[model samples]
Target: MDEMPFCVHDVLNRPLFQRAIVLAGAQGIYREVRWVHILEIIHAAPYVSKHDLILTTGLWLKRSAKSGLEYMRQIIEHQTAGLCIEFGTTVDEIPDQIIDLCDSYDFPLILFRQPVRFEEITQDIHAHIINQHFGLLKKLEQFSQQQQQLILQSTDIPAILRLLQSYSEHQILYLSRIEANTYFPPLPEEMREAINTFCNQQMKHSDQIQEMELWKMDEHRYVLIQPVVCFGQVFSYVGMLLHQAHPTEYMKLLVDYTSKAVATVLLRTQFLEEKILSNQNELIQDILNRSIDSEEQAQMRMGLPSPNGEKYIFVGGIIEFEHNVIEAGPERMESRNQDVLVLIRSLLKRDRMHHVLMMKNNQIYLLCAKARIGKDSESSLYHKIQGLIDGLNKYINQAWPHFHFHIGFGKSRTMLLDAWMSFKEAFQVIELSQTVPAMKQNHYYASIGVYQLLHAVPYPILSDFVQDQLGDLIAYENKHHLHLIDTLAMYFKCMGSKGETAKRLFIHRQTLYNRLDKISDILGEDYFQPQRRHCLEMAMLGYPLIESYHADQ
Candidate 1:
């Protein structure tokens, strides 16, 4: 429970109010009281704020000829704490209708049969109200200090939430999208799932939301949802249920302080986890840099299984990021990395793949190991890894499109020490992905077919090779704005089937024939001969890679 509110019940127990008689609306004696307001004006509802205790001699009602019931009605409409009337001095008398109205609305009405000094009453009550607020502030300060000490001593989320529960005395909920969800006082499993599903839908529909608000969970429940922010990102939310009561101002303050404490705990825990990950990544980096020389040294450095009975084949892979599309600060990038890291781990676990994943600056690397199953072991793992990347692309594109990236895999190695060779092959695959859009679908280095042979050739030689066969045709097509090259390439792709080429190009056969004639005149009819056909086909394949590379620059 929040600090017990100073209510009308407390005020009635004061020495000065001891002689006051309880009229109707006695059941509302617990209404919260903030301060005392003495008003003798008509339309007093606009002058007095909510939770104020009104002290008056009924002067407005007597002078303005307003009904006693109407005056009390205005007090109730303003939501004042209660009404205390000095009965005899202002020619006043209590009306049954006024008492009935107060009773119906649960608005408190207190009567003083004798004349009383209004100034003394205001002074006595105002001091108590101010002192109560000061006491609450001091208590909140102490709670904050204790929370910090507990966080410093241990990065335990549940313990901190439990402490908040002790003060708020409400059901606590900590929901996280990147981490595990935690709740206090225990919740049903189905209820947890329902809440998670609802939250996911809300986030997908619109993630932009206020930091703290009263969210209605169902028809009967409302919760004060406070997003726990760490390093400028909200990865999780922590809230306290409001039961059936509306949250008070001080209660809102309590929730804010507690959320800050939770954020501190999350950041601290992430800091510690990051330290461990950094050390592990250092080992992976050393391997990539070829600093580790021996199999035993590599295994020990990464804490991998020793040279025992089960032989593990190691392969390297990379998820290379595109830098041109994003402009984010280091902190925002780190937060994005954390989110991607969690999703990647979940994928690895689902595939039951043993791996050591490393997150470097612009790329994520995974050194995976599987039991050797004859010569097909590597091939089997290659397909599985391909499927994993495909799944991730499909899932993350819909969920986190900004995480767009290219993927590449290397050949499997028998020894852990040879992991560096795998990484080198992965770099080769990444190079191909940048130049050849077709290579994006073929993640494995072996799947590049003829490109693997061309990879050995120098870049200048490859460019010269393509130009020597197709340079005149390229210039002719560019100058005339013709589709001769496309028609010819599709003809090659369709294996000289003019009908299929025309259909694929969405053109008539006559149009394709005309383009092909132009292509023949620029190059020569002998270009389709066995030797020249081979050269022309190779040039067609290399032309796209060169074109895409230049476009990227």
Candidate 2:
């Protein structure tokens, strides 16, 4: 971070010097230097500016002891960098009294021990300072250009802010103009409120903040605010805080680059955000592919658990749209997909859900975390995930009225190493949900009832198994046009309760008894036996796929 400005300490360390010795006031080494000037005349403070370094031969000091003392005092009063006297030109040695005076004042006094070319020394020193200044400008230029390219390449805003922080090595805080929120190392309540107040007062100009002003909170800490302006108004502001009394020239350049980067991002917000989403989706796929190596790597990729000390439980959600948004041609499908993604993101953001979501294989895969609520009980977690999915379904239904969403979640309280497993399980829940015609929406792997085990069977095998178990009944129903299959499905669903099954079927008890007899005759008298009932339930769960299989054949 550019905490302090260029000082005499920097000049003393330059490679151009022959032998430079500090005589007195070494404590004032931190005194900033604006320019190096040759001051030969006596009482030269009037001509010198603040932080100017005076290089003289001490010929003027040869006049009298009092005059030299007065001249030294003047230099100290004006806050010049220091005195550098070449002894060989006129006076041989610096008087002990003068050195003592400088020491008393804590002023910097330097002695050039050898015969050196003053012209070469002055020019070289100035050139070094200018080069350092230009070097900082070059860095700022490169940073701005790099960030501009990043925007073009669709880097996320938060990632861009992090990159800027890396470049400046300063604490960066981006205040959203719209939300009135802070991002990238978000601050505490008291500090955030104070900063927001300061920014609101400073950013009075709608067009642009006139300059980068260093707002000092104390001797050791300060902030530089640079507004990101668009068109004729300020869209947002970036603050760079450093542990310095004043900011350096280089720090000013950095603040400018930050604001420029922010402006660039704001200008192309849609493209950059979409790009980031697409990239995150790709990252999820890579993680699903088990490409990540460690927890640290996963954290870096995920960027979850907000900076505000938010604890998270990872739950994976799979989105299933009842309507075929994809059948509307590739371009239209892509447009609808983007719209759906936007809707999903908006809803999540509104609810303050921290999530990484992506569309893959015609389903939206989400690894989401809500604030850890109560104990991490499986039921609590499941309900929370269900609630999130339910919210999404509601919003999706509202936005795309014709389309309904069936969302299934996997295990909760999982970490990134186990995220792929959670996603796989959640995806399985969605797939198996097809066989479980009873569970159309908001299903979780652990809560999907009997279908959880049936999910283990391969689809074709499960279809065949269902056919073998229920094929006779299906054939009997088809041949006779009787409502026997429906009656039996309802019978098993009511758990062999004659009264409940009769009530559910809205049939007389005798009619239900007669249907039960017919089902028992076809499947066998052991239909309600424990072992047979288990297979029969599995087959009934797989009935939809079996029917679809026969239809396709």
Kindly list the per-residue Cα lDDT of model 2 for residues 265-312, writing each as its tens digit.
766765667678877887688778988777656766677544233345
lDDT of each residue in 117-145, candidate 1, tens digit only = 98999999999988878977887887788
* Regions of candidate 2 where Cα sits further than 4 Å from its true position: 1-267, 305-312, 322-332, 370-374, 377-384, 459-468, 495-497, 548-553
Q: Provide backbone clash counts, one per model.
A: 0, 0
Point out the worst 10-residue segment of candidate 2 by lDDT.
Answer: 304-313
| TM-scores for the candidates | 0.73, 0.48
Indicate the TM-score of model 1: 0.73
